[model samples]
Target: MINRKILARVAGVGAAATVAMGLFSTGAANADTFVPLPGGEIVKTLSDGTVVTVRLVGESANINPSLGSTPVHRNAWVSGSAQVELSGTGADSGGRIFPGYTVGCQVNIAGGGTSGGVDGGVAWEDGSPSIGASGGGDLSLGPGQAQSFYILDLEQADDFGSETHKKRNVFSGSNGSVTWADSTIGLSGCGGYAQARAFVSVEVETESVVTWITLYGQPFSIG
Candidate 1:
């Protein structure tokens, strides 16, 4: 389980910045930075009928820097959907970014089986490790099948108000076929309070079952 008391202290720029710092540290396996491609496009529309054009900046971790709109919230979580597009030889290179915090995600691969999972626990940088799994059994991947694992994102809008980095105690399982190809990972949220950022980088490493990983969406800090 996540320690809410510790999360309460992960606040402000120092605390929030930790979110980015921890993910991109050089110590981790295949450590790399999230960089955006040039001439990219991003369009975000809110439930209130508000739309904004996000300018392309440096892209990293599959998350686009151009999607710089205030996160909408759902039940106190950042809400809203931002259309993300990556076009170039590097599209399949790195992982993608979501925006603020990743509440949920799905993965699909064309012409291949799917196998992926998300666990909730303090990231390697946080010093503590916790497993965030929604299902009781280990997620499986069969040949030529596509599977998706959905986990409740630990980062919430209310979490922003708290001081410490917000790490939730819940996690989802990965379900899909097993194969090698350029796959897609996506994160979706609702409500004005929920915020998530996605990043894509080729440098990150994953389980052996994953032949190649593409970061469809990852989140980062803006404030």
Candidate 2:
């Protein structure tokens, strides 16, 4: 659950900008920074006349710059909500929501603009870690590097009744939404300034087209 007391003290930005929510002294060298992010939204009209809208809301993060007693380690707790709405004749089977984040070390991950832009700036050139995504944020990185991970790992029975895991949520009708709170984003091995951002990738199916649309959130500093 999000602490409404802290949330009330801060207002939603509604735009992508570096924020400093609060500064609380935890120790002589370990001060925590809470960031209230202004999530974003995008709306597009497909060729088939179907309109799709994706939004990232209620986003925030708490950062601890030196988690491992060294300059190379950092930790953060993040939360947000992704909402998708479809209109017009399409939306046959609703959509799929894949919410994830990308962390970078001395790299650029900012999009061209706030909303309606699809580029997320994720893929690494070399040496990436397999996060299993499943809500695990522990990562080892070097300068000029970055990685991506999904936040959900849902368990469900397959057709044969075998348990399986999924990284996305599927919705029916014309609306789909997912909310996550206090997800961890851990990093190490980069003694320089680091940054992270959130993305909402949704696949909506219609009578004439099946397309994937991504909504980019504001990139913020991790340390």
Candidate 3:
């Protein structure tokens, strides 16, 4: 979560039950598995001599796989950090960072998933992908489907001075980062296997150009 208050937010009703089962169960059937992922790195130099680097670090997931009592449910706690750096003449300018994950149900999300975009397809208002899913990770999907959700729900005042929630963070001065731990991912309604992949999309703005760069993390099994 971008906001400290939002960290470790509940994935769904199943999270509590899953945690309890992991505590009391002794057999491998209910044991939790911890996976350490090799976070990735990407660098791109904008034609204007602006160098941008994005890295996904400290990535991991603790999966309960199943509730054991239900074949349609899976639970996991995920953690990671998204870091960005900018250099060259435009480094001083600011940009927005949006970090989230795409969870698929028997759908191959590699290289950006199916035609329109992952499950439910990518939402683009003006030819740019906008990850604006506000609903939490408690998802329902069928085979060959997928969905995306952001890890941040920042609370702040809008132009009218009323409370509003923002999914991205604004940063400046050549560097910015967002980290989250124990973020819950609860799934339901897919009788088959499921998988999830992390994504960090950053909007970089220099004097002459505004570009979006997205980096995808390795996908992992939910069961």
Can you tell me which runs of candidate 1 are displaced by over 4 Å?
1-41, 45-49, 52-138, 153-223
- TM-scores across all candidates? 0.20, 0.77, 0.81
lDDT (CA) for every model shown?
0.22, 0.65, 0.66
lDDT of 2 by residue, 1-223 (tens): 1212111111111111111111121221233788888888777778877777778899988888888878899988888988877777674457777777777787765632323121223432211223333334777778877777877767799999999987777777777688887888888998787877877777766666767766667777887
lDDT of 1 at 64: 23
Residue 157 C-alpha lDDT in model 1: 50
Per-candidate clash tally: 88, 0, 0
Task: Output the number of the lDDT-best candidate.
Answer: 3
lDDT of 1 by residue, 28-105 (tens): 111122323232233323232222222223333323212323232111111222222222222222222222222321
**How many Å off is the CA of 199 in candidate 3?**
0.4
Q: How do all the candidates rank in terms of TM-score, highest first? A: 3, 2, 1
Residues 114-153, model 3: lDDT tens digits: 1234544545332224554456667777787777788888
Better of 2 and 3 by lDDT: 3
User: What is candidate 3's local distance difference test score?
Assistant: 0.66
| Candidate order by decreasing lDDT | 3, 2, 1
